[model samples]
Target chain A: MKAAVIGIGLIGGSMALALKEKGLIEKAIGVDNNVTHTTKALELGLVDDINSLEQAVQESDLVILAVPVHAISGLLPRVLDLVDRQVVMDVGSTKAAMLEVIASHPKRSRFVASHPMWGTEYSGPEAAVKDAFAGRATVICNREESDKDAVTLVEDLYTTLGMHLVYMDAAAHDVHVAYVSHISHITSFALANTVLEKEREEDAIFELASAGFASTVRLAKSNPETWASIFMENRENVLDVLNEHISQLRKFKACLEKENIEYLAELMANANKIKRILK
Target chain B: MKAAVIGIGLIGGSMALALKEKGLIEKAIGVDNNVTHTTKALELGLVDDINSLEQAVQESDLVILAVPVHAISGLLPRVLDLVDRQVVMDVGSTKAAMLEVIASHPKRSRFVASHPMWGTEYSGPEAAVKDAFAGRATVICNREESDKDAVTLVEDLYTTLGMHLVYMDAAAHDVHVAYVSHISHITSFALANTVLEKEREEDAIFELASAGFASTVRLAKSNPETWASIFMENRENVLDVLNEHISQLRKFKACLEKENIEYLAELMANANKIKRILK
Candidate 1:
C-alpha cells in the first residue's frame, strides 16, 4: 500500500517511519506546509518523496492527518471530499471537534479518527523516531460511523506496528485525554513556570535539580504550537481538570499549613493507588 | 573504615550498598526502629549485621542518618552527643529545619548535613538498590559549621562513590529543594488525585494512560510517611512554591478559557526553556 502522511512533523513523521518499518506501505510520501519539515523528513529518510496534499490524496491508498488539532478539523473534510476508496485517518490529540466538523460530510465513511498515545517533548521532522508507537495505546473514536473497510485497514496497520487499539466515542475520548494526557502538559508547564518565577537565580536551579524534578517537569519542554492548539480545542475539559488539580493542591497546602500529618498521609496513600494503574 | 546506617530504609540501605560497592567500608551495620527493616536489610545484604543505635555509635567510625526530616532533626543531636571523634551525617531532604534543630549543640561540629538529589517513588529496605548515589548531586549544607575532619571524611566518601558534592547555605538549600524537588511531588500527587476524582471509571484511565501521564505522575506513588514528613518539615517553603504554582495554573486556565491563544502560546514557549536546564 502507498501512504501519504500530512504535516510530516513529530507524529506524522514517526507514523511514516512505523508504517515503513512494518513493511505495510510500499511507499510513504510526505506532505507539509513547512518546506523545512518536508526537506528534513526526506533527508532523514522518513519518506520516499515529498508530495502536495492534492497530489498525495490522488495517488495514495491511505492518507494520514497528523497535524495540530485545529488544522485537523479543517483539513479532514477537504481530504475526505477528494478521496474515493482511500482510508484517511488522523492522529490528532483532540477528537471531538474534528469529528464534529466532518460529521455530515458525504465521504465521512472514509475518515477514521485515531489518537496514538505516544509522543515526546519534542517536535518537527527532526524529532521523528523509529518504533514510536510500539506498545502504546491508540484510541479510535466514532469507529461505528466509519466504513468497515477504513476501520479495518487502520486497525490492522496499527496492530502490525505493535500498538494496542481501543475504541471510544469522540466526546468520551476528549474527556479521557483531558484527564490522562492533557492535564499533565498543563501541570508540567505550570510547574516549570513556578520554578522559573520563584528561583530567579538560574544557577541555583541548574545545580540542585534532582531526577524527580526533571522527570516531573519533563513535559514542560513540549512544543508550544501543538500544545496551544490542543489546549484551545479541548478547552472545557482541560479547564475542568485544571480546576480540580488546583483544588487538590490547595487541600494539600491547607493540610500542611495546619500540620495535619494524618490527613496528609491518607491523601498520599490514596494517590499511591496511581501505581496500580500506571503499571 | 566501619560504617553504621541509622534508619536502614531506602536512603540508608542504598548508601550502605554504595559504601560496600566502593570498598570504602570493611563492615556496614544497620540500625532501625523497625525489626522487619533490620532483618530485611541484613537479608538483602545491605549491611553486614543489625546493630542498635548505641552499639553503632560505640563501634562505627562513621554514622549516617537516612531517616525522615523530622526524625533527622530529633535524632542527629542525640547521636552526636554520644560521638567521641566519629563523623555523623544525614541524607534528609530538608536542610534548614534539621540544621536549626542541631545548631546550638556542643557536638554540632561533628555533624554534617547532606541531601542527595536522588530517589525513587518506592520506599523501605526493599526499595534500596546498588549505585543509588552515583552520577547524582549531593548537597552539603552549612559545611562551615562542621568540623574539618568530619567534612573531609563525608565529602571524601561521597566523592569515592562517584557523586558530585555541592555546598550551599541551609536556608537556600531548603528554598531550592522546595522549588525543584518538593513541589514536583506535590504536583504529581495532586495530579493523581485530580485524575482519580474526575474519572470515576477507573477503566478509562487504565486504558488511556500514556507515557506522558506515567512520567508526569510517577512520583505520586511515593511513600506517604516519607513525603508527609518532608512537606511538614519544609512547610513554609513548600507553601510558597505551591502558591506560585497555583497562580501559574490559574493564568493558563484563564488563557484557555478566554481562547487567548497568543498569551497561551507565549506561556508555553517560555516554559519550553526548561529543555536547556534539563539537558
Candidate 2:
C-alpha cells in the first residue's frame, strides 16, 4: 500500500522511515508546507517522493496526518473531504480536539486517532530516526468509532513498528496524556527557564549540569511551535495537570520553609512509589 | 594510597570501585554503621576489607565521607578529629553546610570539600558500578582552605577516576547546585506526587508514560534519606530556586489560561536556549 504523510517533520519522517523499512508500504509520499522540511525529508530518504496534498491523498491508500495538533485540527476536516476509500490516521499528541473536530464529518469512520508514545526532544526531518517507535505503546483512541478496516490498518502499522497497542476514548486519552506527556514538557520547559532566568552563569551550568539535570531538562529543547500547539489544544486537561503540579511543588516549598524534615522525607518516599510503576 | 570509604552505599561503594579499578588506592577499607552494607560492599568486591570507622581512619591514608548530607555535617568534624596525616574529603550533594561545621577544625587543612557530579536513581552497595564517574564534572569547593598536598591528592584521586575538576567556593557551589541539581530532584519528586495524587489510573500512567515522562521523573526514585537531607541542609538556596521555578511554571499556566498562544510559544522558545548549554 502507498502511504502519504503530511507535515514531514520528526514524527512524520520517522513514521515514513519505519513503514518503508518494514516494507509496510510500496511508496511513502511526503507533504509539508515547509519547503525546507520537504527537501530535508527527501535528502534524508524519509519519503520516497514529495507530492501535493491533493495528489498524494488521491494516489495513496493511506493518508497519515503527522502535523502539530493545531495544524491537525484545521487540516483534518479538509483531508477528510478529500478522502474516498483511503484509510486516514493521525499521529498527533492531542486526540480529543482532533477527534472532536471531525465527529460530525461524513468520512469520520475513515479516520483512526492514534498517539504513538515515543519522541525525542529534537524535531524536524533531520531528527528523524529509524526504529523510533519500537517497544513503545501506541494509544488508539475511539477505535470503535472508526471503520474496522481503518482501525485494523493503523493497528497493523503500529504493530509492524513493534509497538504495543492500548485502546481508550479520545477524551480519556487526552486526560491520560496530560498526566504522562504534557506535564513533563511543561516541567522541563519551566525548569530550563528557571535555570536560565536565575542562574545567569551559563558556563557554570554547562560545566556543572550532571546527568540528573540533563535528563530532567532535556525535553525543554523540544520544538516550541509543536509543544505550544499541544498545550493549547489540550488546554483544559493540561491546565488541570499544571495546576496540580504547581500545588505539588508548593508542598515541597512549605516543607522547606517549615524545616519539616520528616514531612519532606515523607513526600520523597511517596514519590519513590513511582519506582514500582516505572521500573 | 590506602582509602577508607565511610557509608559504603551508592556514592561510597562506587568510589571504592573506581579507586580500586584505577589503582588509585592500594587497598579500599569500608566503614559503615549498617553491617549489611559493609558485608554487601565486600561481597561486591568494592572494598578489600571492612573496618570500624576509627580503625579504618587510622589505617588508611585517605578518608571519603559519602553518607547523607545531614550525616556528613556531623561526621566531617569527627572524621577530621581522627585525621593525622590522612587527607579527608566528602562527596555529598550540599557544600556550604558541610564546610561550615568544620570551618575551625584543627585538621581543616586536611579535609577537601568535593562533590562528584554523578549518580543514578538507585542506591546501596549493589548499585555500585565500575567507571561511573567518567566524563562527569567533580566540583572541588574552597580549594584554598585545603592543604596544598591534601588538595593535590584529592584532585589526583578524581582525575584518576576520569573526572574533570571544577573549583568554586562552598557558598557558590551550594547555590549553583540548588539551580542545577537540588531543584531537579524536587521537581521530579513533586511531579511523581502530582500524577499519583490526581491520576487514579496507575495502568494508564504505566502504559502511557513515554521517554519524556521517564526522563523527567526518574530522579523521583532517588533515595528519600539522601534527598531529604540534601534539601534540608540546603534549604534556603533550594527555596530560592524552587520559588523561581514555580514562577516560571506560572507563566505557562497563565499563557494557557489566557489562551495567549504567542506568549506560550515565546516561553517555550526561551526554554529551548537550554539546548546550547546542555547539548
Native-contact recovery for every candidate? 0.90, 0.92
After TM-score superposition, the amount by which residue A200's alpha carbon in candidate 1 deviates from its true location, in angstroms, is 2.1
lDDT of 1 by residue, B180-210 (tens): 9999999999999999887888888988898
Candidate 1 per-residue lDDT over residues A248-268, each given as its tens digit:
999998998899999999999
Clashing pairs in 1: none
Weakest 10 consecutive residues of candidate 2 chain A by summed lDDT: A94-103
Stretches of candidate 2 exceeding 4 Å from the true structure:
none
How far residue A82's Cα lies from its native spot in candidate 1, in Å, is: 1.0
State iRMS for model 2. Answer: 0.6
The 0-to-1 C-alpha lDDT of every candidate, in the order given, reads 0.91, 0.94
What C-alpha lDDT, on a 0 to 100 scale, does residue B261 get in candidate 1? Answer: 96
RMSD, every candidate, angstroms: 1.0, 1.0
